[model samples]
Target: MTVNFNARPLTKALIFRIQKQNMHYSNSKYWDFCAPVAGILLTLSFAPFDYSWLALAAMAFLFAAWRGCSAKRAALRGYLFGLGAFGSGVSWVYISMHDFGGAGALESSLLTAVFAAFWALFPALAGYLSVKMKGPGQVILTPVIWMLVEYLRGYWVLNGFPWLQLAYSQLETPLAGYIPVLGAYGAGFIAALTASIAVEICRGKKRLLLITALTILWGTGALLRNQTWTHEIGQPIRVSMIQGNIAQDQKWRPENKINTLLKYKRMTEEHWDSNVIIWPETAIPAYLDQVQDAFLAPLANDAKLHNTDLIISVPVQETAPVKNFNAVITLGKEQGMYRKTHLLPFGEYLPLQPLSGFVLDLINIRLGNFTPGTATQPLLKAGGYPFITLICYEDVFGDLSVRGLPDAAFLVNVTNDGWFGDSIEPHQHMQMARMRAIETGRFLLRSTNTGMTGIVSSKGEIVGQAPLFQETALTGTINPMGGMTPYARWGDRPVIGLMVVLLLGLLGYGKVNVGRISVTAV
Candidate 1:
């Protein structure tokens, strides 16, 4: 007898076995260990590593681990993931605190752990809510909750950290095309949505539909990348960004103050023939009043003679109720001043005062208590055109950058990232600064202390860059871009508002579905 053996049943049986194994693995206690690994994977997706695609896999792993689990288990898994992500991603905090902030190794480690733990709660909250709001459409609801928590962590909690956002990882990818139209958070939502769809497909739920949606989303982004959101209106101008390479420990010492000032002044002198000369944050190393007549006045005069604009950052001290502001002043052709409106918490000004003060005292860490500048200050003039000035940490806030819209010809950011030292912080900071350029549709001139000083094109590409830990001037030509991208015009309102509406609609639909199920049972 001829046996008609079919391969279809064997293939199906093998597929069933693999699916069973996957399901078992996801449900097992060992899956909780994957949470932190997923977090690390997400970190690798960001700058330095630039493994952008791993971001999707990391999110998928976390989502799969959260599925079919109890609220308590999900919270534990979420916290673990957060701990892993923040721990690995921002361990630079220890470098800043111990190496520069005068905190002991033990104290710095404890404080860093505390900082990471605090941010991790946001993710834990997201996981808890996802489980509580569990419904037939969990794939949709989970991602929404995740993005909401991300917004809270980045924008609301403790004056906003906004580091290592998923959108930053997608900068080189086609998804980056969404950045100009939708802003960083909006692009992040799309990334989260894609991750959710991927999880559903892995679970064998509407694979064709999910696959189609994925294709459309990325394909649209690829097409969008070719579109020019902003146009260049004026002639190209030569710009020089001075990277002082000042050591963090020695920067504020009274002994090094004059040397620092002279070094930057000398650097500026060399680039005076350029249309614009920029300095790193606190490059003056002294209050403006202290250096006004002796140093800056002559420098301003020289810049005017050369027909070049000098933009410098120095702390401005005001008496009568004593306050200091992180101020940027321009000299030559046009005179303007921009005080930093957004300040870095803990670094610039401590929050939750008494408690924060006590903790810092315990760790032996001292920080500045500078006053914030007014919100509606006029755009500063540089290279004969109005431009937005962001001092150090202010550039991290996207909405803050949008305030000086189509009126500003370009963007300038001055930073002192030496505090983080020979670490990933500077590179990560450069990544965020590039995003600001893309969002505004303007060339971003970023000058920094201790490297990564560069010129970012309107498309977010680094056109000119200085070596890390090197004292050098990065020279480049940038056209004054006019007009605004969609992100610059609307900011985050449209994207955030849509997310809120979608979440509420899903909740309402879930409630209705439950009601129908109850009626059928009765």
Candidate 2:
């Protein structure tokens, strides 16, 4: 199916060509795209939907199989391939919007299609750009394109959704060390690069050195995961993470706050033996100043007297009247607080007040307008440990925790997922957290308001966790760890910078040797 670039609008031949291309792709005209199209569709099943590494590897092979006819052809195939990948990857969004998001099947499907289309564009752009930038002599430009597109995915539209990002491949993988340095996006960039490298190697391309180089890099990460990144400087400490599976609707109700606090107190009372005890997002709903002054006064005094440290979450007001989020403090000996910088779109804050009623009506829920917190200094000290803190969905954002509090100790992430309720969304959330722990090399202690609480060491190992939708205290000892992962220190700058260099490097190489490559049937 060929597209005529010179066609005028409303021309019969132009309309016929459009119809021809559509029919070619969907029916039988464009058999050339069938393999790549199938390969792309196959990738959707490889995601969390099935969790198969073999499937991922196969997609890589298939993508390489049907690639490199011409620059325009490559881009078109890539676009078609991505349509298949994202169309299936985010099919669950339909469940979220229909089952949980309160939309009918058709409405949800349309919304999901729009979302998938946006995601597919990134990969399409990557494919097109790779060919455009690919060097003539032994080039692996697919990875370069992938990294750039992934970087684009991280921005655009309320900060791009890195969901289904390539980093998740390392969630349960041994390539954990790369995460701490490159961040998930960084790791993803490497993964895409490696896949393209593998493709080039398969094509009998020169050197085959990049494949070996990538292997050695990740092999080093595997060996290094067992090594402790940070030395212990503080005395031993313990923490009790309480998971209250309270429904989101009932969590902040005036009457329910009492039960919520009581539930945490009861579940955690026995664990007071631990040096530090933490609760999930808004485990206590009242603000700092609004707290029964008498209650907190005694609570703080007792924690100090008992030689304990307490870090808890509660919505606190910012200025005299404005309310920014404050998962405020009751730290023992020295008290400090962390305000969540990034707030959830609908859950914590409502945007465009004129449409507030319309949005709430769409979801069948009340929406709050929570303000963003100042770049509050790191408040990581607790029972002698210093760490960085992020509340709720904040853990999903890349570099925010590391950049916001670089040079801190480990990571402390508090979240409440009762709202998602028995959905795969929570598991998706957990997968992202695990990648973060790996990328930063800092011990990640995640305490969820409802469940999926755990400890992730610098090596990305999950040493402890509580199951979802339960009320209980998960007590565990964790290292107050710190270390500079490549990503932690440089983020994706290295990946992007290198890609730019490669683009320039390839121009000369392509000019010198691409004729030979074309002759060889690439």
The candidate scoring highest on TM-score is 1
Q: How many backbone clashes does candidate 1 have?
A: 0
TM-score for each prediction?
A: 0.94, 0.80
Cα lDDT of model 2 overall? 0.66
**Tens-digit lDDT track of model 2 for 1-522:** 433342233344654676576544333325335544553544443334545354346446534633534455555665566666667555666665565555677776776787677566665666566655654532355665666676777654454566666777566555555676556665666666566666667767654576678678678767755655455545556877777778765776798877777777677667778888887887777877776474566777877877888878887776878666746565677787777777775456655566755855775645456777677565567767667788877787766767643566678888876665666557767777877776667777888877788887666668888987777788888766555665677876676788778766777676544333222222
RMSD (CA, Å), each prediction = 7.0, 7.2
Worst 10 residues of 1 by lDDT: 513-522
Please give the CA lDDT of all the candidate structures: 0.88, 0.66
The TM-score between candidate 2 and the true structure equals: 0.80
Highest lDDT among the candidates is held by which one?
A: 1
- The TM-score between candidate 1 and the true structure equals 0.94
Q: How many residue pairs clash in each candidate?
A: 0, 8
Looking at model 2, which ten-residue stretch has the lowest summed lDDT?
513-522
